[model samples]
Target: MDARPSAWIIAAVVTFYMSAALVMVFVNKAVLNSTPDLPLLFLFIQLIIAVVLLHAGALLTPKIEVPPLDLHTAKKLTPVVLINIVGLVFNMLCLRDVEASFFQIARGLVLPLTISASSIATRSRPSISVSFAATIVTIGFFVGVAPEHTLPTASVPSGLSLFYGFLSSLFIAIHAVLIKSSLPFCSNSTIQLAYWTNAGSAFFLVPFILITGEPGNLLALVSDPKWHMSTLFWGSLITGVFGFLLCVAGLLSIKVTSPITHMFSSAMRSVIQTLLGVCIFHDVLTTNRLISLATILGGTMYYTWLKSNQPPAQSQRPQADQEALDNGDREPKVGWQAPDLDEGLNGKN
Candidate 1:
């Protein structure tokens, strides 16, 4: 077995896991329709993936040459780093409330809004065209929102969830942009930030788990198994592998057509899941659903196109410079970078 194939297989696995998670969670009806752990979930999944990717990375290290960690050079970055942690918590909270499918929809909505918000909030002038494109996506999102997939008009996470979810996405986007912005200054900030955020989030969640997560039930949740494998087994697998895979894969894989990408796929997952539910599981799809589906696909196509074309975004340039300057690069460099475990998380928006 040549090591190269295994390396490619790992990269491919991310995409597979992400797409497969939709099927797994949907089939088991474990979609975070209400209450999912975003940060802990991210921590759980990323920990496993980091292990796999890092291990695989070592084998490929001779080939790829990942950079070494730099010391935390500047003190000014502390505030943004703190904000990143808070953002992660809110994102997790939002994820816990919504289904994976709808959560994905919320994910799609956040990409555009984050850029626009950063421009105004930070006093940075992002591209008007990108902002306009994002506006279209937002409008399309609301157009796509249907009563069926939406929360009970007055539900906690439904309307509120969407708001928080969108906000969470913004935070994440801001974090991404912020990370990329700050990357230039230190050269290690992106990876350092990732490590810190993971540890920081764990620090944050530890108290929550102790205070709120019942040790007995959690143990039971892990040890207990049923229906061929226990809920604990499946949940762990879902939480640990499937969730991480979906997210990491989405992040790592090639920038192909959005139809295949999770942005659209997440939304697509809902349609297929709903269709399967109605046809196989005998779920219902109203006329409104039919139209929403079309609208979502259309809007997603537009957003996806924007995302795809967004590489040339004139707006993110200054932010990217700020990022590279902060992360580890002593020299000036900006734009997108790859996604991976030890290094590769930070990239252009």
Candidate 2:
């Protein structure tokens, strides 16, 4: 099979990924608003749904093979799954407390945080332009979300909400770097990694849901007759379906393109979501907020352009056999190579 996809394929996958991501955010926000107390439970349900869909896809399509899960892979993927759960939980918490428009501003921090994590993890330094762009993005996020900058009539996010949003960005940044480092163990298949991690997340989230006392809240919600026809119920179902679609599309996008591309798509998705939030939810859009959003988007676009203009870096490591022949350093016979730091995020290569 040709592992490298065509440009059309990349375009299609990115479009699908961005569209699904945009819709999923709104769905999650709606569901979280309708049932503010069960954010973790809602995420747990989404994970379950994603697991089911992934398994079904593998079973139905012979071409899409799911690697067997063994002890070694499980141990390697545990941290990734745990981090995913934490990031997701924080994301929901932020969504529950912050407006949809401001939510993207919070998430805008992920790019800089991811870059910082990557630099620390792999000893890789981004170009000066990339660093400068990251700084601009950081400033933009602050301008967009700071409470003091808002008009007196405008509602601002609470300190707690901003804290949750920051945590969400930090956790997701860490998750991205960890997933990148763990990709070699997963045979470099984003689909396979996504499936196993999602399954593991579902497994781990079970105990968390129970410990958080969400099962009782879930039962109460389900048992209430008035809840059946409410937005909560319908929104949950919609988000569940969209959640699976988003994961699949996200994996495909990362598979076909670089993580930088994925980040750019995410930035664009944030732009669309912010517009939708303003229109659909009547979110308070202050002058500073708009300018901040523009700054973030502009920085992201400039970063993307800079990345595109740069030549691909040469590989620093030789083949294992070659290395052994040259340096007489015998390494383990693990047929894995560290993926390019610039290529994909969150094990997407």
lDDT of 2 by residue, 128-183 (tens): 66677777777777777666543543466777887887777777666655654566
lDDT, model 2: 0.65
C-alpha displacement of 144 in model 1, angstroms? 3.9
- Model 1 TM: 0.57
The stretch of ten residues in a row with the least summed lDDT in candidate 2 is: 340-349
Clashing pairs in 2: none
The root-mean-square deviation over C-alpha atoms between each candidate and the true structure, in angstroms, is 8.8, 6.4
**TM-score per candidate:** 0.57, 0.83
**Global lDDT of each candidate:** 0.42, 0.65
